[model samples]
Target: MSTSSPEHAIDRMEDRLARLPLRERKKLRTRRAIQDHALRLFAAQGYDETTVEQIAAAAEISPSTFFRYFPTKEDVVITDEYDPIMAEAIREQPAELPPIDALRAMLREILPQLFETDLDALKTRLRITAEVPALRGRTFEGMRATFTVLSEAFAERTGRAPDDPDVEAFSWAVLGVLQAALYRLLDGKTTYEDLPAQIDHNLRFLAQGCPL
Candidate 1:
């Protein structure tokens, strides 16, 4: 089983917050509160039916505060607290490892963080993103941003430019594997504990040319 225990994940979050200035930490808390309330509202009602004012009221913040944290309703579903942390973890992988190997290592390291999340909320977010057209576009945009982050990490490790064909290709493949794993996991096709192993297995197949 993955070793990313809930306590450890919470600790990581707390530690991260500890390093931030007080104002920034407050901003993060407000953002998280807004997102949590928004997802709950989206799950209870249809995403299209849930207005920003309702979400803000539920979160005990004004609509203006919601706008300050999330530029639009779609951003609530598309953006996440984990992307930057994941990118940093990817960068922390041993320099001796190949780009794909580094990504594999990073994924393994972060799997337990998944346990720290509210699974139902995640499922709701995914469902909304999958079914809503606007959310779908925003999802793609978010994925593009993630690709850029991973590509830069790969490029830095390999002493290449972010747009270098090799760097871009490798980053896409890694992100693709991650996306596939997440889709399957969120579909309830696999046990939560098996998530990391599933990703690692698929990454291995990817490394092996995805043989038949």
Candidate 2:
């Protein structure tokens, strides 16, 4: 019953979007539509087999419009919008809370957004990442990009240098848990709704120093 769960974060995002100018909102919708259709097409056909023109056609946008939103086809799967949001959430967590507790809260804040996401699309994306070596490399690069933001926030809270070993270790451990949870979910070991509980249990284990 955390107050700052995914639904709450979504509510905040909705409010912010509500205040955006009409043009900006329309742009956001168009970007989303393009991404949604791109994923659908990518899932139906293999990534290498799917062309940008096909994706654009499915989304009812021209190829030029697709490029305006995403620089390349790989960018659609590589770039993640949640990284900054979660990083900011982690930074905004109460200073009085313990490190793990703060991280848990941050995860909760984002999980609701994940819940609303298209699980089929996510599974397809993960599957593609697993199957494509180039995409896999890009995915790791994308993860490193987010890790920099998260590690800095962790360092600030711990009063350590951003590159301090302790900060890096803790950040990697957290990311590892999340990655494992995601893989398990994609592998059909867990359902979409079970993600929160699985993440909660893993975080609790880490909070307890990873007991056997």
Candidate 3:
């Protein structure tokens, strides 16, 4: 339901870029260029078959430069700018709303805009991540990182310690439902356009005590 187009997303990205110091803006641009070239290479070739050297060549950077941007080939597939954005969005949700409701609201607001920004790259990343064992293993690390982000944001909003047992449980529960929905998308059971609805449904299930 957001009429936000890719152009709108690009304009927003440009605005954000303009606010960064020149050096930081250059670094961010380089990082994005590397990721774009890497994803294209991954899509053209297979994930495993696409060498780091090849991606560097495509991006017109050295392999060492590629490593400076992404530590590993798998990192190119897994790393993204979305986590901090999501964390901020989580914190900005209506204070009166419960944590799960806030998260649901944030996803509803952000995901469509995000999808519009780079749906093709996201689809390629998800497909490659699903089909590759190394990427799958790497994602557990990413999941843990995401859990920390969610927990910290929830803690800030709710005035709880980030490490509090209740906060930890709630964050992991949200991660679980999100992971399940991602699996559905990777399995072709859901389209990108429908993914937010699927995530909303899953979160609603969790909010209802997760009855069997």
- The CA lDDT of each predicted structure is 0.79, 0.77, 0.85
- Write down the worst ten-residue block by lDDT for model 3: 12-21
Q: Write the per-residue lDDT of candidate 1 for residues 1-212, one digit (tens) a residue.
A: 44566777778767755666688677767777889988888888888899989999999888888898898989988877666566678777888998778878887766666556555667678788768878766766788878988888888999999999988998888778877887786577876667779899989888888899
Candidates arranged by TM-score, highest first: 3, 1, 2
Q: Candidate 2 lDDT (Cα, whole model)?
A: 0.77
> Over the stretch 137-183, how does candidate 2's per-residue lDDT look in tens digits?
77666778678887888888889998998899888898788778877
| Model 1 quality (TM-score) | 0.83
Task: State the number of backbone clashes in model 3.
Answer: 0
Q: Against the true structure, what is each candidate's TM-score? A: 0.83, 0.74, 0.88
Best by TM-score: 3
Clashes of each: 1, 0, 0
TM-score (C-alpha, index-matched) for candidate 3: 0.88
RMSD of each: 2.7, 4.2, 2.3
2 or 3, greater by lDDT: 3
